[model samples]
Target: MNPIEARHWISAEDKDLKTVSFFHLSFPEQRAAFEELIQHTPAIQVYDTIWQQLQELMKTRHPAEKLSPDLLQQKAAAHIGNGPADEYGVWVYYPWSQRLVHILDEAEFVEMRTSRNQHKITAAEIKTLAAKKIGIIGLSVGQSAALTLAIERLCGEIRIADFDTLDLSNLNRIRAGIHNIGLPKTTIVAREIAEIDPFLKVTCFEKGITEDNIEDFLQEGGRLDVLAEECDSMDIKILSRQRARAMGIPVVMETSDRGMMDIERFDQEPQRPLLHGKVPDDLSYTTIRQFSGEQRMQVALNILDYDNISEKLRSSIHEIGKTITTWPQLASAVALGGAMVAHVCREICLEHNIPSGRYYVDPDQLFKL
Candidate 1:
C-alpha cells in the first residue's frame, strides 16, 4: 500500500512527515552519480516531486535576485533540513510498509496543502480560523460537518464527541466502511482529519458528552467557538444546548430531512430558548434520560417542529419501532447537513450574523416547479 493510503500507520506515530532535503547535484559529474544511484534503487521515485518542488522553494525565497545553481542547491538543502540523503535526510519509518519515507516539514506541507483555499477564504480569514476552536457532538451527520470544516481549514482545533461505534448500518450516512466497524466514531473521524492534515489539533471524546464531562468539553480549552449538536440521544441533544447557552457558545444542528438546519447564536441572545423553545426550560435532564423510545421520538419531532417537517420524514416518524427500526436518513441529506453546518460555522466564527433561527436547505423547493 502507498504509505499515504496506509490507514493504520497514518494514525500512528509514523504519521508525522520528516523534513527531508531534496538531493541536489551542483556539478555535471555529481548529477551523473545521482542518476546512477536512482537507477540502482527505483524506490527513490517517490522523491521526484520533492526534487521539482525544491526549485520552486528556491525561487520563492529569492524572488528579486536570480540565484546561481550552487546557491540554489545550498539553500534548498538548508530549507529542507540540510544533510546527506541517509545522514541529514528527515525520514519516517512506516511499519506497515516497512519503508522509511522522506517527507516535507510541517510548514511547507501545510502551505502547499492549503494553498488552493486562498482568496476565497482569503489569507486573513485563514489566519483567523487557525486560532479558533470548533466543537462537534454526535459523529453521524456531524462527521460530515467535521470533515467539511477540517478540509476547509475553518478552525485550527476541533473537539469531537461520540460514544457510538461504527456499525455496518451506519455506512449509509456516516461515511465509514466495514473496516471501521466496532471502532468508535470519534476514532475514525479523528484519523481521517489527521490524514488530511496532521498539524490540525483534534481531541476526541470516546464517550459521548455527559453532564459530568460537558463542562470540561465546552470550557476546557477556553470554550468552543461553535458547537454542532447532532446526536441521536435526546438527553445529550438538549443538555448540550444548555451547556452551550451557559457558556455563550453558538450552536448549530442539522436534521436529515428536507435539509432542515437550525443555528442558535447563544453568544448574541443568551436568554434564547434552547431549540427555540421546543425543548422547554423546565424539562429536566433526568426526565429526558428516562423517556421511553416513543417519548424520545416525540421530543425529536417537537424540536423539528412537527408542522414544518417534510412529508417523507413525517411519514417515517410513525414507522419507528413498528415497520422500521429507527429514523431513516439518506447520504444526500447527511452531506447537505455537513455543508449547511460548515457554512454557518464559518460565518459565526468570522463574526457574521447567522442569527438564531431554523432554516431549510430544502432541495425539493429549490428545484421544484
Candidate 2:
C-alpha cells in the first residue's frame, strides 16, 4: 500500500493540465493518516463539501448506515475540511484532506449545475481553434457559468475576475466550497478551472472590474468572442455592455425568473439598446434608471400580487441580494439554466450565421428557446 491510495489530490502540473490522484496505503497506515493528518475537523470539512453532492446520488444519502462500507471509504479521501463540525452544517476543518469546505445549502439558496451532453462541445470547430479568452466577473453566477464552460473544454483560455471570496452563503449559487473563503473569487475560480481541465488556459483578474480598467480588463485576451456579464454590479453591467459593443463583440446576459432563463443578445446591432447604450439619445442615464426602476417594481409586484406567490417565497426574496432577486429558483434550475444558456452562447459564437437573439428556458412551465 502506498501513501496516496487512501486520499485524493487535485494536481496541476503545467499551464494546462490537472488530475486527481489516489494512492495505495496499508489500511492501518491510512487510518493513521486519517487520524493524524485528516483531523475530525478537516474530515468533516471534506464531508460537507460533498454532503449535498453525495446525497443526490443515493449512494451517499444520510443516516450513515445507508451508505455501503466501500462508499464510506471514499468519504475519507474526499474530505474538504480539517475536522468535524460541531453541528450538522457547521464545521472548521477536515484534517485528512486539509481542505476548507463552505456551507451554502444551510441557507437554502442555490444548487450545483451539470451538463447533459459532454462530447457535444469538444467536436465543434471552436475546440480545434485553440482556447478562448473570456473575463468572468463575480463568483455567484459567474462561477457556475465558468465551471460549465471550463468542463466543456471549449475555450482555449478563460480569465476570471472577482474581488470577493467564497463563503457559506455563496454555496447556494457558487461552485466553490469553504476552503476558498477570503481567497478572492477570481483566484478560486482560476484554481478550480485549472484543476478541472489543465489543457485550458486560465487567467485571473482578482482586483475586481471597474470602468477605468474595463479596456485593460480584456487587453490580455486580445479580441474576445464574447463578454459574459455575470457580475452583480449594475454599473459594471453598463460599462461592459458599452465596451463590448464599441469593440464589436457579442455579449450574453441572463436573468433567471424562478426556474426560467432569460437571455439578452447584443449580437444583432448596436442601435438595438446595448444595455446602457443611448436610446435615440433622448433617454438620459437618470431617465433610464428611473425606467429600469419602474420595470423592476413591476416585476416584484407581479410576483407578489398578480403572480400570487406565497409570503414565504416573497420573504425569501428579501434575504437575497438585490441582483439575485431578479431571478430565483431551486439549485437545479439555476445550475441547468447557467449551463443551458452557456451552451447556446458557445454554439452561436462558433457557428457563424447562427441566429443571435434572446432565449429562455423554464423547467416548471417547460419553456425552452
Instruction: Report every candidate's CA lDDT.
Output: 0.75, 0.51
Q: lDDT per residue, candidate 1, 119-196, as tens digits?
A: 677878888888888999998789999999999989988888888889898999988768878877877887677656
Cα TM-score per model:
0.79, 0.56
Clashing pairs in 1: none
Please, what are the lDDT tens digits per residue for candidate 2 over residues 1-369? 654331112121232222222211224454454445445443343434545543443332344566665665466335434543222232222232345343322222111221223245343454443445655666566677778777765566666667676666667666666776655666666667644443456666656776567787666448666667776555566666667766766776554444333233555665556443312223233333455655544533532243434344566666656655443444565577568656755765675464444444545456535
lDDT of 2 at 365: 52
Off by over 4 Å in 1: 1-49, 52-82, 85-102
Q: What is the lDDT of candidate 1?
A: 0.75
The most accurate candidate by TM-score is: 1
TM-score of candidate 2 on Cα atoms, chains taken together: 0.56
